[model samples]
Target: MIVVALRARSSWHKPAWWATAFGAIAVATYGILWATPVVLDGMLGGRNLLTLVRDAAAVAAVWFFHNAVAAQQRKPEKKLPAWGLGLAVLSFTVPFLLISRPGPTSSAFVLDRLDQFPVWLFSSIYIFIVGALAARAIALLSSEKTVMTRFYVLGLSLMLVGSIIELMYLAATHFGPTNPDFRESLYYVAERPFFGGIFITVLGFLWVYAVRVFWKHLARWTLRIDARHEGGEYLARSLATSSENGWSDRQLAVNSAVNIRDRLKIGTQALSRREHALFSGVEHLLSNHLERTPR
Candidate 1:
């Protein structure tokens, strides 16, 4: 993420910038998780606000990822209207705030709060948004033939599948099972694909960025070589033009050989006996033709 951010520092509107944002926000979401909800909840006033923040960050990261993919495909950089985004945020925030979080901050927030309506509401909204964006990304990348696009599609497909599994698990927990162990097992099963998908997606982005940088440097090197050998290149082109303009096959071959020799700075003495003999004969023949040509 830091590398991407540095590379994208020049332009805020490029696809790289959006990709950087996606990476950063995704990292932050997990950073919160790694900090442990107990610590974060206490710092944020103990209403499990960290969970809400984590879910919000996850949604934002996915949204940024969708934008990155769209921009990479050369789509218009249209963002969701501010009002719509605000309303969506409010929808999630209101439910979370209204729900009672009476006990000490639980490490297993999702499993413990599965029975709460607000928890279900928050989870449903997050899953739905993530699923939709992942599906859109898959659809966008399906038409692209690049290796990076294939990786992107595969990653997004995994994410979409994970979202579907999580939704189903949520429903089962509500309607089918009340057992804590069963819910925990189901949660892990559903969570693995999402994290795997994220890993693969970030890898794809970094790989593609590195490839682009390599090609850019290669192009610069070729351009420098072209500039340095301008005279040799011009001579080669002139010889080709003469050959195309009704020069005899013998004349063309001799001229092309001479051009190669001069371009490589090969001296007559450097030629092998047979090669020296052939060039001498061709030069003599060319001289005779030049002498006979009308002045």
Candidate 2:
């Protein structure tokens, strides 16, 4: 996230900035988890409201990630209006708040409240939003044939699959027997894909960034070599075409030829065989011109 934030400093309007925002929200979502139920329950008055906040942050992160992909592909960034997102939050929050969640918050709030319809509604809503966005991202990324896009698609596909598994788990928990061991096992199974997806997606983005940095440096180096080649050729031609007649003119031509030679020598490795032959011909021309010049 820090790396993306620094990259965003200059390109705040670009896709990288959107990616940085996504990273921040993702970190916050996990940070909520890392804080643990005990700390969050204490902080939020024991209602597990932090779980709602975490889900909301996760949704926002997915939205930003979708925007980043869209921007990278030069597609229109289709945003759910602020009101719509708020409504989505309210849909789950109102029901979750209305439900009676007695005692201190559990580490697995959803699993603990699996008997409640409100919990089901909350989990369903979250899964639907994430799944819908992941599906959209997959569709968007599929059109592009680049390696970067492929990785993005693969990561999103994994996430979409994870969301599907969560949906299944939600249904099973709501309808089937609430065996703690089975529920916990299935929950972890649903979670694995999300972790895998996050890892793969981050890796893909890093790979693309590294490749871009390499190519950018290579381009600059190539430009410098080309500049040297052009400078050498220009100076050589000018010296060979000189019509001035004096010892000073001869001396000046000698100096210019020497400068051109130095440039050619510096960029010798970058020069092609044809370019080498061309410079050799120019050197011969300079020698002839020097011999003809009046002392």
Candidate 3:
């Protein structure tokens, strides 16, 4: 996640970097927030305000990554729906009002039942979108060769697996056996897989997103530098050949210098000032060598 943030800081223009950074941060933030929710709950004067915030952050992360992946495919950027954004906002801003319960069920159960709407809606949208995106990435893996593509596929796959496990936990709690013993057993059984999957999924995504952003520019820089070196080599060869022939062929020397100059310009702009100075030195040497030759 730190790597992704640094990459994004360097390349703000690329949509993928921004999206991946946001997604990585969102996951990390949620993990941190969830760790000491009780303290936050006390600080905020609420039982689960942080939980609601966490849900919204998760949804936002998914939305951002969807945009990132779509941008990578050269697809037209789709505007995010206002309603979805509004729902996330509402999840956080909605008043945490409590209604008096008059039944065998405890007050906590009543509150939990009431809490279902916002959390379920957020979870459903997040799960569905992530699942769809994962499938799309898998389909794309057959043809795309970029490092980003492979990592995206791997990251999405891990995320999908993690999401499925989480969904199973949610489903079991919401609709599975109601027996207290069964519920306790299920919770214990599901704990490791649920958290482990999330940890691995986020780790995979960090690699995918960070590599894509950094490697794209790194590869471009490498190619430019290599081409510049090759141009310099061509210039060196022209100077050597021109020098060896001496005054025997003045026209040939002139022609060789002109050829060297043209090739030297191929990627001259990519070089640093010091490298440019070196190129200029070579050019000067070539011209002087040609001039010294007798016509």
Give me the runs in candidate 2 sitting further than 4 Å from their true place.
4-8, 12-16, 29-37, 77-84, 209-295
As for lDDT, the candidate ahead, 2 or 3, is 2
User: Which candidate gets the maximum lDDT versus the true structure?
Assistant: 2
How much is 96 displaced in model 2, in angstroms?
Answer: 2.9
Candidate 3 structure, TM-score to reference: 0.51
Query: Please, what are the lDDT tens digits per residue for candidate 3 over residues 1-295?
Result: 6666565556666655655565555555334545554554445555444554555555555555565555556554453453765665454444322222222222133224433544444444555555555555466454687775665566666666666765566565655546656555655454454355445545666676555545444333333444444664654554456458752233343354444355445634344576456445444545654332111
TM-score of 2: 0.65
lDDT of 2 by residue, 21-90 (tens): 6556555544464675577556778777767776776676677677777766667746434576677667
Clashes of each: 0, 0, 0
C-alpha local distance difference test of each model: 0.65, 0.68, 0.50
Relative to the unseen true structure, what is the C-alpha lDDT of residue 137 in candidate 2, on a scale of 0 to 100? 82
* TM of each candidate vs. truth: 0.67, 0.65, 0.51
Could you tell me which 10 consecutive residues in candidate 2 have the lowest summed lDDT? 241-250
